[model samples]
Target: MSDQELFYLLALLKVDGVGDIMAKKLLTHCGNAESVFKAKLNQIAAIDGVGSSLLKKIHDKSIFEKANEELEFIKSNNINVSFFQDENYPDRLKHCIDSPVLIFSSGNINLKNRKLISIVGTRQITSYGSEFCKKLIEDLVPLDPVIVSGFAYGVDIAAHQFAVENNLQTIGVLAHGLNQIYPKMHKKYVAKMEENGGFMTEFWSTSSPDKENFVRRNRIVAGMTEATIVIESADKGGSLITANLANDYNRDVFAVPGRVTDKYSQGCNNLIKTQKANVLTSAADLIYILNWDVESKSKAVQKQLFVELEPEEQKVYDFLLKNGKEILDFIALQCDFPIYKISGILLNMELKGVIRPLPGKLFEAI
Candidate 1:
């Protein structure tokens, strides 16, 4: 479709109560956004949800003029827009019941990746959550999967940062419009992400970051990815909404196990116990659950044995290898080393491919 037509479709979406299903019905009857724009009051009133009241309001010339003005503003801002029927629209999200009719983007987006995993968790992530997110990203890096997450604090930030560091593409599905980044503190990381990956939203540039918008935003994250991973969430956290949405969308849901006594872990543990999400202890768990077929991942593991490491690094690696995965605190205790020193050694070992980090601040030998 032409740019003007696409803009008109997006404009229609901004109308109150004209959601995806209703808009689609109107489009089916009228043929396209242009046709809908040109429809008479009576013609519009024939469609579902288009009552005489809505039809009269839609027929007002002032509304169309305002829409046109908004279109002009969007054009002036150089924001990238996509309609539901466009070829570039993300296929994974297209089939969702509440899929947006238009999406505004401000970064490089590759929607064709076969493997997309979303990592979401509490904004107030503990050290355990951060470590879990870091290791999961590192393991998924070699598989060349596209990482998706919100650009919020905690697990979201860690996921995006690790993806960038590992040279993998990451997409931040924002709750607000592309006109600005939320949590303004993450502006630098958002800028860096635009250079490497991209940002996406259904809201217009003038749209505010309202509370309801975030609940709506989680659907996009859940719909666009092949799987959703909840790193660490409280019993009532928003990450649970995303996981439930993923399940509704027929996408895999994985939850990293956390201590039962910890408040932050209650959601994840509940999900696993209730069979709402698979118990994910490592990246390998995710790979298997999704049935990802990257032979290279296995080859990368087998390429070298006895990976070179410093004595301290080797100690950490040997300990993890022998004991399976262990949390940082536990590893430190086992190795009789200071927590700070053990952290440095583990990071070096991770870089040297001597071990792999798991979600929830755990590490295991490759």
Candidate 2:
């Protein structure tokens, strides 16, 4: 959008009683932010929840001054701003009701037609969590998913670091403005991160890393991605909040289960037990659940034509061949093998190009 358009959009957001939903309503009715300001009082009041008091606040001129200040910040710092309706805005995030009308970003970021997954967890990450996160990213490298996180310590940084080490794009959703980095310790990573993925935020330059900003920050982390994965989280923490936000958005949520005795695992364990998230045991689980492996099905089927299958592999392969395609649970039941055992067999078959995994646990003989 042009600077004049963004100036009006920024001003509209500053209106006292107007938030994302109300702002969207006004924009829909009036066509644009500038139009909303120029529209008659009756036109603005016609929108739902627009009381006389809000209508009166719409005329506040001070908001324009604030908007101009932010516009200057955007121009001077080379910050990139995305209006909600802009093509550059996150596609998934645009569908969210509470998404910010304008998001500020900096770096070399491109999410078009790309797979995005957020990996978040407790600030005090454990060795188990770290290893699981590392291996998960390594295994997922083949799929080349864009890794997203809050850029905090622990699982967030670990996820970003692994993505960088593996040469994958990773984005950090910050709680504060682009002008500064929180946990100042993380300042060192700013340059490297901006080189590939960069940072995103809805907060303005004047906004600080306040307590409430983090909660709002979590939504973007959850909203923009195709799925949110909790590598490890305490019974109560920011990651769980993000998981809930992902669920609210009707996005996939996965949590890594750990021992019940482990404090950090309790939140993830609870998420799985309550059916809020899928059980994420490995990269295969995510690949299988999300159908990332489906693209290789045709190739696997071609390879299966000449490859010899083992007796056990042949049995599973025959069942899949006849069934066409089936979920992992059903394959285990029909084949008379344990579910745990089926995964290993399936992997061997996958390597041999005998069968392929599909989304939502389905598997088929290639």
Candidate 3:
């Protein structure tokens, strides 16, 4: 599509009473976005949701001029626009019921990766949730999965941080446009992501991050992945909305279990009990369900270790391998080193890619 056509399509998305479904119908009836803008009142009204009043409002030339101004504003910001028919549009989200007619993006737009997974959970996360997210990313990094999240606090931030630390690609789906990052504190992280991954949104640059927009954003998160995994959620958390949308999209849903008494875990346990989501026990379960080739991943892990580790780091590694997995306290005791010294050694070992730390203050030979 030409730049002018993309501008018109984005303008249609900003119109009142025009949603994805209706916009799609209008686009089908009229050949392209330019044709839709020039269509007669009766022609537009013939579509299902278009009424006489709506058609008259859409027919006003002033509205088209405002849309033109909006397009000019978008151009001034250097943002790229992708319509539904564009080859770079995400195919996974295209099949959804309310797929956006236009998407505004910055940075990479590759969605053909088969091992995409969406990690969603409560904004108010617990210590358990944070540890789970860290370990899960560490395991999946070896398999080279593309992590997707909302880039919100708690679980979302943890997921993105882990992905970056492990040098994996990740994508953040925003409720608002790319003009500003919500919560503002995440600006640095978002900038880093643009270099390594990308940011995507359905709304234009002027769209504000309103509460209602989040409900719309949740559908894209679910639609864009092969599976949705909820780490921790309350009974009525927004994570459940993504899981429900995943079910509607016929994508697999998985939930990590927590203590039944913990309020944060109630939603996940309930989802599993009601058969809405499968219970997730480990990273291996997700790999198996996705039918990824683990043997090749294992080989890659070995190669990474050989190339990344140094001689002194190999000494710490041999110690961990001889004793198997152990707690930091146990390792300190065995090595007869002070706690601070042991910590420094362990950190250096981790930096060299010699070993991995598991949840619950344990370390394991990688």
Candidate 4:
């Protein structure tokens, strides 16, 4: 984008009540941010959700000052700015409706045609979580996937370290701006990380690592990646939030099953039990589910051949086999089962690799 265009885009974002979605809407209507500002009030108001108040806010002159300051920071720091429609912008993230119109980054990040997965968990990392994270990254190294994480404590840092050790690219998504690191101790690792992969954020230079910003940051982690894995988490935490956001985005979500008594494992277990995530026993499970490499024989398929299925599961499987693919409600009704029971039965079949779940609650025999 040209400097003039970038200036207008920055100013457009600074307009009160204009978030990513609204900005995109205005841009779509006016063709560009510069036009959005110059267009008559009636023309702007014609767009849906473009109210009188917003039109008034769009004219505020102070927004231009803030935008100019941020623009200067971008120019001085040489920070790479990704407009959502640009090629350098994360492809997967572009599909998310709420993704930022502009994201600032400082890294040698390359995500084109690459497998990106986010590994997140509790801040207090356990030996089990750490080891599992290492092994998972180690096993996945052969595939050369790009690792994405929050760059926070616990599984996030561990995943980055493992990826670096394995010589794989890893990108850290930060809650704050690229101007400073959140945890001061992580500063030492920054140089090496930027050597291969680097940090990304939607926050401006003036933004701090506030509590709520982390929650908003989680969406980017979940959105940009094809899958999100929760190595460990409590029943309620940011990791689970990311997993849920992944699910909402119709992305694959995996959780490592742990002993029920473990506090950190509770979130992961609940995610699995609630059928919000698949049971991630190893990298093989994710590989099979995502169909990353069709040539590789999935152990899951081999196991499914010898797996014994319960009678209820068999009935549903037989129905799907005959019908090709059916929605969840249809499967429950046709098989003479309740919705709740069918859900659990299907989940069990999925874990067994006897059936695969598709978008829109559709399921089919595999």
For each candidate, what TM-score against the reference? 0.81, 0.85, 0.80, 0.81
Off by over 4 Å in 4: 294-366
Runs off by more than 4 Å, candidate 1 = 296-366
- Predicted structure with the largest TM-score when compared to the true one: 2
Q: Give, for candidate 4, the lowest lDDT window spanning 10 residues.
A: 294-303
Candidate 3 lDDT: 0.79
Better of 1 and 2 by TM-score: 2
Model 2 agreement with the true structure over 180-273: per-residue lDDT tens digits: 9998999888888888899999989989999999999999999999999999999999999999999999999999999999999999999999
* lDDT by residue for model 4 (180-268), tens: 99888889889888989999999988899999999989999999999999999999999999999999999999999999999999999
- lDDT scores for all predictions? 0.80, 0.90, 0.79, 0.88
Off by over 4 Å in 2: 293-355, 358-366
Residue pairs with colliding backbones in model 3 are none
The residue-level lDDT of candidate 3 at 323 comes to: 88
**Candidate 4 — what's its lDDT?**
0.88
- Pairs that collide, model 4: none
Q: What is the lDDT of candidate 1?
A: 0.80
Q: Cα deviation in Å at residue 300, candidate 2?
A: 12
